[model samples]
Target: MTITHTKAMRKDNTLLAITHLSQLLHYVTGFGGFIVPLILWLASKNDVEGMDEHGKSIINFQLSMLLYILISIPAILLFGLGILSLIFVGILGFVLPIVNAVKAANGEAPSQFLTIRFIG
Candidate 1:
C-alpha cells in the first residue's frame, strides 16, 4: 500500500479499537458502556471504511449483554441462579470488549460470540 493508504488504515484501526474499548467507559460514567461507543461509532463510522461493521458489532454485544442481565434479574428467585449468571455476564462484559479492541487494533474483524445483532 502507498504511504497515504497505510496512514489512513492505521487511523481507521485506531478508531475501531477505540470504538471497541469505549465500552469500558461504563465503569466510570455508570452508563457509558453504550453511550460512548455509540458516539464514537457515529462520529467515525462514515469516515472509516470498516467502522460501520465494528460499531454494529460493539453495539450488538452491549445490547445483548444488557438483555442477558435483565433476564438474569428474574432468575434471582430461582435458587440464586441469577447471581451466578450476573457474575458470568459481568466477566464477559469486561473481557470481550478488550479482546475485540485488540482485534480491531490488529486490523482484524471482531467477532462477538452470543451477540444479538440489534443494529444491523
Candidate 2:
C-alpha cells in the first residue's frame, strides 16, 4: 500500500485582498511591497485558491513599475520627461494596489495596466 499526500487549497479572499494591498508598504516603509506579497504567495500558493494568479500579477506589476522607474531615471536628462514618468509611476503605484485589493476582495481578477508579464 502507498500513501499519497494531496494539498488542499481554500478560498481566502481576505488574504488575497491583503496581499494586493500589501504593495502599499513601499509608500509607508520605502520597501517590502514586493517582498511581502512574494512571501505570501510562496507560502500559500499551493494552499490558497487564486493565490498563484494574483501573486503573479502582483509580482509582474511590481517588476514592471521598477523597470519604469529605472528607465525614467535616465530619461530625467531628456527635458525632464523622466520626472513626468516618475510622477505617473507614483500615482499608478499608489492607485493600482487599492483597486486590485478591492477586486481581489470581490473575487475578481486583477486589472493592472501597463504591467509587463515577467512572472506570468
Candidate topping TM-score: 2
Reference-based TM-score, model 1: 0.88
lDDT per residue for candidate 1 within 35-70, as digits (tens), equals 988888888776787898899999899999999999
Each prediction's whole-model lDDT (CA)? 0.87, 0.96
The candidate that achieves the highest lDDT relative to the unseen native structure: 2
Q: What count of clashes does model 2 give?
A: 0
Pairs of colliding residues, candidate 1: none
**Candidate 2 residue runs with Cα over 4 Å from true position:** 1-3
lDDT of 2 by residue, 1-120 (tens): 999999888999999999999999999999999999999999999999999999999999999999999999999999999999999999999999999999999999999699999886
TM-score of 2: 0.95
